[model samples]
Target: MDHAPQLIQERSAPPATLVIFGASGDLTRRKLLPAVDNLARHGRLPDQFALVGVARTPMSDEQFAESALGGKSLLDKRQLAGGVRYVAGGYDDPETYKRLAETLDELDAVRGTSGNRLFYLSTPAGAFEPVINGLAGAGLNQATETSFARLVIEKPYGRDLATARELDGVVHGAFEEHQVFRIDHYLGKDTVQNVLALRFANSIFQPIWDRSWIDHVQITVAETLGVGTRGGFYEGAGAMRDIVQNHVLQVLALALMEPPVSFEGENLRNEKVKLLQAIRLPTDRDVSEAAVRGQYTRGGTREELMAGYREEVGVDPLSRTETYAAMRLNVDNWRWAGVPFYVRTGKRLPARLTEVALQFQRPPHLPIPADQLTELDADALILRIQPNEGISLRFGAKVPGHSFRVRTASMNFSYDQTFVEESPEAYERLLLDALIGDASLFIRSDEVQQSWRIVDPIIEHWERDRSPIPSYEAASWGPTDADRLIGRNGRKWRNAS
Candidate 1:
């Protein structure tokens, strides 16, 4: 007798049609389709399912599907076998969406989806309004007893607070707040979820989690590759909006949030919102003191490989775009009042990594001699989110030698070392959540707006000042000032740590 859960066997109530508005775009080919396919391959997707892709290109459904999914032979063979429906035309044209709604209907005719649909806004930021309007104008949002229409939007949700709020208004015109899913892919990481497990599930860490015991928290997301093809997008977005406003801040929230009452979507999101709200928005002086923005010039480890930001294709010759950003923020609450949470992210750095390092201060006074205790350092609890996935705790213990001295040691738990089979990729996990109707990892609209609110003033400060924002080597962590941004305060960047 099979004992697997019924939900694992039965198709979810969600109408299983994934309608991609910009199916031909880079994200669809590189990320969305693959993520959806991974869900299907792992049996996380419902059996009655269809993917309807919308685009401006001149291609038949077969061509669209083939171009996007067919070229994915380089990926796991099983995942590439998933099928999808593709519909192409200008989203600006209402007739295109009329045709897309018809395609959803046709798929429903056979699959018994009963008008249920998940609309993915994979198009450009400019197209968000038109596409959203087109869907409603085409009656795609019409409610029925059995049919559910949900919207899943890609990020760069907006460039600033006003724009993000305006975009939310536009999306809300077609779908209610409950129907909207604003995904921040960083939240999908296995290690990001593990952060909660490490803190809440285990009793060992929480006791030392408060300001009295913890010194500081460092959340960093670094990338080794420069903006290549997305220079057009990166030039305007910059590192702050690209990483911090959404990804890095979300990571920070995961690291700093109070234990959720439960793991349900709304319950978890409530804690995240609270953590974000607790963060004191930077004052002008705070901006001047706590923030540093930088760009990359023509220096890298390989002399022949140097390429400045301006020299990159699709970038302005005098672009003030910042590829690197670092900031020190204080959450204005009793738990983290005195502790500064340092955040940083950048492109074309030494390597690609995302980590949260919680540094614990040294003992108030070591009874042992300075020479004897010199080997002991501040304890750091590190959760590496990528490149390698693991948790390490640095603590002091008695040295093996007869002499009475303390030495730092690392207690390590690596995902690879423990798991026999593959860990589900972040995309795969996130796609499954969408299928199961979970938003624990997805940002709420208010969260998105608040993030933009916290970030917009920094954008304003840069626009008005227009200083050179300093440039660093392509392969370096960031500009020299970034080092002093942390070091002057007796702290150091984790790359150095």
Candidate 2:
């Protein structure tokens, strides 16, 4: 059995001010603000830390605080409200940017938080350029000896490869590569990072991690709910661009990358970039054979009816958008040669779960009779990423009662059982990492471009092919074609349920 990971004490972040561009947006209320509050509760926030909210909506600091951190005692509300301020103006206006700079300067004096600034672009993708340009105009993107300036941009970085490169150029103009942080909350999950710890820190798994011992890998990110009101946004970004392009690909890199010489930001990311570069870019013929796309149809009883993709609000009746995607990929390098890495993601599936499973090659010889081992399954190592974060090792074992009958059994290690304190939310760990200038968990510019390079061909192929998107019931795992995509190779998706 693998030993549990050692617990580390939390450290406080440096004194700085966090400026949010879309403070009135849903992300702020649902994720950002709550994460900050949780950090404060854990005493991970610096004493001089402060927040400055900038948005087009006109509102006082008091009102903004109430809207963001409401339903608290007066004293508790006032404590967090003390360090917050709000600025209102158009995102493209130079005057608004000037006011933001002045506000941060004032907070530096009043709150004793140096000129250190961490600007968060929580606005829509369209607003990213204008906001970055405005910050540059105000000279807020530069760093000094005593203070540092970091910019955190949210994802769906661009529509495709061309757009992603253009956006990178514009962002590089305002801030140097070292000062920019491209956040991917998936990396913040305890289980996701635990993958690295499992391979590098342990002695048993590392030896058999290469192609000689492993057969194949599967990564699945499924959702239990549909795009209720974000249908308009979902139309532009199908599963390939939204999930596979960024989150799913990043997970793949972590699972397959070579161990770095050191765990420093640059050293770790360098190995990941190399792994991504090694993935074979699917050819036109491979695209048709290796890719599967789908949309969901209505299902369930009338009283509990589910809406189809076309029936969702703000979506076109004849939309060709895909809510589900599955693709088979291969890394052409020595370590992973001939091993297929299958990845799939979708909405309105049977359950909400994210996981990576490594299926090992079956034993070359079995001394027992085939009939006695009828219940045996291929040995697998599953790393569950959410809901119940744990590591499960599945292997065949002899049945207790009798004559050498073999059955599959699992040895599980759960985070809740191993550690006393709750794991930090993905956003919380990501936020603190940004504040402290540790870019190890954040994506690099080159890493982003390489991922886009791998995804662009598939998007183009799907467009030109104009393949009819298959449909499955709202709560099914996915379309049958996805099953067939893997089934053709004499394999199947792990029954995640």
Candidate 3:
């Protein structure tokens, strides 16, 4: 009997023109354009693919291409550059959509895009409604009988639950639920997706995955760098809105969701929504007890002193915005009942890491003497999502000595060592998925609302209190309060190191 894994091939995206509304933005230069280039290089893009960039900045097609290429002489990128077109217009202006519709038509004829369109709203949040209205006004949202029209929206989906629902209303006004892709880049990461595969594909872990065997789960997304020039943006969107509301919550849903019937877009997203809906919402007392927020202070090495969050450019000196946030969440479902999920994200931490760690309960009875197992640690299965992406299982093992001493030992699997093919960037995978009309990795509307529902109360509680936000050293793990938040549950935040 052969036990080897079979190679499953992915189909290339059909011919389509991707229209980016914020082509001049930093995200476009750093992620979107490069991701498209990578897709073209891998032959994942259709040969008839075309790109139309729309921004307020007025520039010729050649100029936009040069700016996008950023002087990179790669042949595939240059070829992609060849088909790149530019339209200069204001997002709110009806005339802009008129010009954009004309541009798409031209691309269909010149580049053979087949009238299939993927409109990407990388623009500012304020522009989302105007752009959607403009698209609808231009009749661009209506797809031909033979082709499809989809919209890809970037995050900070809304400031809060009310706003998110409002944005959904606007989005649904122009496109159907199936045609709207709410992009949360975290879901595209190889390790994040692996959570599903690890849980469902393996028979060994399924039996012990519930509250009976697992004690808790930890999801941490730490960054070593400060907000820098993005302090302006970060001011309005603290750690909770920026990370926890979307990325952190999305990862949590994936870790806790039930096995879906199939990997279809709706099936997977439905499962995620169900899991998110099961999360116990935080009340006033729950927020006060289970949540902690902090701002980074100047406390790096003398050689590399860092500015405090308040001192950052464009930030108010007395800014109450939290650069760090830690919270304990509970899923009130049968499988995860009584299992607390601790989530934390921060900037200017000791290390840059994104991981989900599941700590198994200690054995009910140990045959060895208590003294012999003093150094033994609980077994933990960790899924590392970034910066040395891999998985590791830490378990108690016998020492290599005469004594029956036991210590924690890890069995590790590194993506770089195990696979020759490099994992694509998150945006690359997500962009290609959007182009291929796969919404499995995309966020569904209910998923967004449920996540917001879970976090909205805590945000309101924090806003009502005018207390000073706690502070942590720039390079430290987080505020002592964060430790207390987890410590109250007899747990501690797992250090990235």
Candidate 4:
């Protein structure tokens, strides 16, 4: 096994034309184009880079460019205007793809791109297959030895294991495993990458990273707002499919994956795949014991009333969809055999934060008197992923007094305070990685299936049971059962505040 890590080169990708399938969509305007602009501003974009927008709506290249980057400075607008071109056509039409292929070829000739291409499927999930098949039918899936072609598929890969596998099969028909990039923007966060750096780059933590010293790991991705205008989409996704399956699980893999021999794309991804496969998948009975699901109810004063999940604009009156979910998972492996991994995510919570906290076991012998230990907490290391980006270590310390009264004190390191430069947004880093052919931050097909495999049974159990879904208040952490899920194990969930 190769374990030698390789240094990533800080170089721009060769000239390529990035084709976004849903160019007229909200994501294109809000995230995609802005990310590209940021990369260009940083001098990271290839000199001959180009963008081709494809969508059903008919618009001229100038109109599409304006819609995507309209508010930019004069210089940026001029530079973007020349590289951006639009092709208006339906996703299912073969002729549309033919025109798209011709457009790419023309861009290659005019822009000196040398036929390199990246196809980004920003369209709805339903359009994924048709778009993939359309590209394969148009002979755009394969690249010559000197050139390359890659595809970036956005999330909600499938509803469940079977569907995920089917989607994988469909994707493979057009692009090889190496040619596909399954993007999860969470993996691009500076704090997330910091997890790997903090682990593998340091000697102090690795020796205690496994079962002997660590008691449990908690991963939380919380949101304080309701579904809002996305209630229709939320009805089908909920917290499990939306947050847990993709985002939370991926974070878990990062926290738990063994150090790879190399940071090469395949080597790093292999360890993550192993971590997911080693998850002690929950049985039907295990689901009832280890998992808790809930939806948020109304809260706040009359003038500031909030709506419940069912009361959301597009939700069903009696929807069983879970807006909040918590689970206790165990990984059956040598390094983490007895350790538990607790993950929870929800909307309308007390705050919007994403974090991972590792609670270490108490010392074998507490020299302090039992009375003096009342105020002390177990040693903890927290990796804060959002809102405030930082790492904090909590340890017991003596209160300033004659008596040895103990209380926890935090030693903190914050990205904002410690660094002079602002970290780029997640989308910006992910887009640049895709452009440069770095698959390290993206999920692979097998990793997706493995995650779904762990959650599918729990989803099934939740569906079969007729019991009413639990509820929490709009601004609370989650359902009380989530407390019990960990409390039963003589532990408790960490507070985001």
The predictions' CA RMSDs to the true structure, in order, are: 3.1, 2.9, 1.8, 3.2
Candidate 3 TM-score, true structure as reference: 0.97
Residue-by-residue lDDT tens digits, candidate 3, 4-65: 99899976889999999999999998899888878877778876888889999989998998
Residues 309-386 of candidate 1 have per-residue lDDT tens digits of 889999999899999999988898878999988899988888889899999977887788889877777899999998
Pairs of residues clashing in candidate 4? 2-261, 3-261, 4-261
TM-score of each: 0.93, 0.96, 0.97, 0.97
Tell me the tens digit of each residue's lDDT in model 4 across 1-497: 88989998666666899899999898888888888888777777877888899999999988987876786542456555577889999899999999998888888888888899999999999999999999999999998998989999999899999999999999999899989999999998999999999999999999999999999999999998899989999999889999999999999999999999988999999999999999998889789888999999998568888888889999999899999999999999999999989999999988889999999999999877889888788999999998789999999888999987999899999999999987888898988888889999999999999999999999999989999899998888889999999999799989866
- Once superposed on the true structure, which residue ranges of model 1 sit more than 4 Å away at CA? 1-15, 68-83, 302-304
Error of 2 at 79 (Å): 4.3
Worst 10 residues of 1 by lDDT: 74-83
Distance from true position, residue 48, model 4, in Å? 0.5
In candidate 1, clashing pairs total: 0
List the lowest-lDDT window of 10 residues for candidate 3: 70-79
lDDT of 2 by residue, 1-497 (tens): 99999998767799999999999899988899888888887777777889889999999988987776685332465445588899999999999999999899999998988999999999999999999999999999989999999999999798887898999999999999999999999999888999999989999999889899899999999998998999999999999999999999999999999999988999999999999999999988888778989999997568888999999999999888889999999998989999999999999898899999999999999888999988999999999997688999999998999477999999999999999978899999999999999999999998999999898898888888765778989989899989998998799998566
